[model samples]
Target chain A: GAGVSQSPRYKVAKRGQDVALRCDPISGHVSLFWYQQALGQGPEFLTYFQNEAQLDKSGLPSDRFFAERPEGSVSTLKIQRTQQEDSAVYLCASTVGLQETQYFGPGTRLLVL
Target chain B: EDKVVQSPLSLVVHEGDTVTLNCSYEVTNFRSLLWYKQEKKAPTFLFMLTSSGIEKKSGRLSSILDKKELFSILNITATQTGDSAIYLCAVERRTSGTYKYIFGTGTRLKVLA
Candidate 1:
């Protein structure tokens, strides 16, 4: 793909349900990132990966939020026991390296009811 | 704590009006500053500034970073309704052989046509 791709542009989950959001980064990009954005706010850092290596997860709000990129290509973010506060847009971005311009995806909008 | 903040959290400007969005940051080791424009979906890359005092321009948009002042400003001339969106500013840091990026709260621009 010419740009980053995210699946299920919109998702709705119950309070106790778990959901997974997928992201396919740009081809040959070595770095990928995840971010969470609330209504009327900017995207907040969630995690980072450098070719399948989870370099940083400090931005994850809690242990319930898990992200994995085992293949260095596609990645998934899973949220457990969804809460209303968790309703936000999840964005995925890819860059050529640690210090490069990152291309963004359309993002997945999650609504927890 | 590392942080970035945008001023004029929200603004409404008539078409053809020029506006300036401000962003200030405090990072341990700032590598670069980036700006993005958020539409109904994802945020698209606008500009990246690493060296201070060098202005980057694309169409009617331009941005400049001041390392000494730890701030960046984006200028949009002759705005249109299509220019209405959330403007995000992020700061990148290089640490522990890895790269980290953080985002500010963002400034919402509403251009009235």
Candidate 2:
């Protein structure tokens, strides 16, 4: 089975620009999560969705970070006015249900110059 | 604030040697603990533990959780060069109707031949 997949394995953007990272979870996965990972560090939670509903956004660093999962399938993480601080790997994960084992994607590495 | 911490941020071991990585977490509504092995891209799931005193084993890798102490340990016996990677620990907590994960800084293991 295909695990979670993310697009644009690498991205370079100028400061103040907007960037969108895409994620395709496994078929029929009901839970999706986004995380940010800095170099030499573990991933930090960014947001979570159950089906098409955004269940947890508290982990989002700021208002600039937004995510949505429409039709209970694909998801997108959009960062508005990108900053150097946002230069990190954005990871996506999916699970079959609540509290289940999460399968992670390769992640999209974003660099803001 | 919820947090996960790993010990010995980095380690170097020779092949055929055994090593142990530690993870400790503090969070509200504790649920489960997970271990992941990351190479260059995606992190591969190793184990998910929800009970204490029970050990999960796979090949040369094994992990045990201690809920009462809010910590877990991952052991890799007869390590190989392929075992060299960052080992991450995550804790899941349920809030409201959703679940969130808190990850540790990770322990980097470099196995030498």
Candidate 3:
């Protein structure tokens, strides 16, 4: 893909169900980022990965929220025991070279009901 | 914690009108300020400002950074209906080994036809 690509444009999950959001960054991009955007709010940093290594996960709200990029090219964000507060648009972005310009993917909108 | 604040939560303007959006930040070891335009899903990259007094322009959108004031402004001239979107501002900082990015609430702009 020319830009970052995320799977499942929209998701509806029930309480306590686990949901996994996938992201395929641009080819050869070294940096990948995940953000969570709530309704009427800006996107909040969830985690960052530099070539398959999770350098920072401090932004993850709780232990239930986990992310992995085992192969460096693709990533996944998983939320365990879904809660209403976890509903939001999960966005993925990738930057080429250093952390310079980021290209965003059409986010996966998750709604927990 | 890093903080990014955007002013004028929402704005409406007629076509051809000019508008200015403001963003202020407070972060430790601030490395750069970035501006993005989010319409429905992804937030497209707009500009990245690192040094003071450097203005970035593309078409009718122009942005400038003021490191001394810890603020930045995005200006749009001759606005069109297509310009309606949520404009987000973010600040990137160096914390730990990787960079930390924090975003503001964003300003929603509606350009009337």
Which candidate leads the pack in TM-score?
Answer: 2
How high is the lDDT of residue A52 in model 3? 91
The TM-score obtained for chain B by all candidates, in the order given, is: 0.98, 0.98, 0.97
Error of 3 at B37 (Å): 0.5
Per-residue CA lDDT of model 3 for B23-79, tens digit only, reads: 999899899999999999999999999989989999999999999999999999999
Model 2 fnat? 0.94
Clash pairs for candidate 3: none
> TM-score of each candidate?
0.97, 0.99, 0.98
CAPRI tier of model 3: high
Could you give the candidate ranking by TM-score, starting with the highest?
A: 2, 3, 1
Full candidate order by DockQ, most accurate first: 2, 3, 1
CA displacement after TM-score superposition, residue B70 of candidate 2 (Å): 1.3
Can you give the lDDT of residue A73 in candidate 2? 94
- CA-lDDT, candidates in order: 0.94, 0.95, 0.94
For A58-96, candidate 1 gives per-residue lDDT tens digits of 999998999999999999999999999999999999999
* TM-score between candidate 3 chain A and the true chain A: 0.97
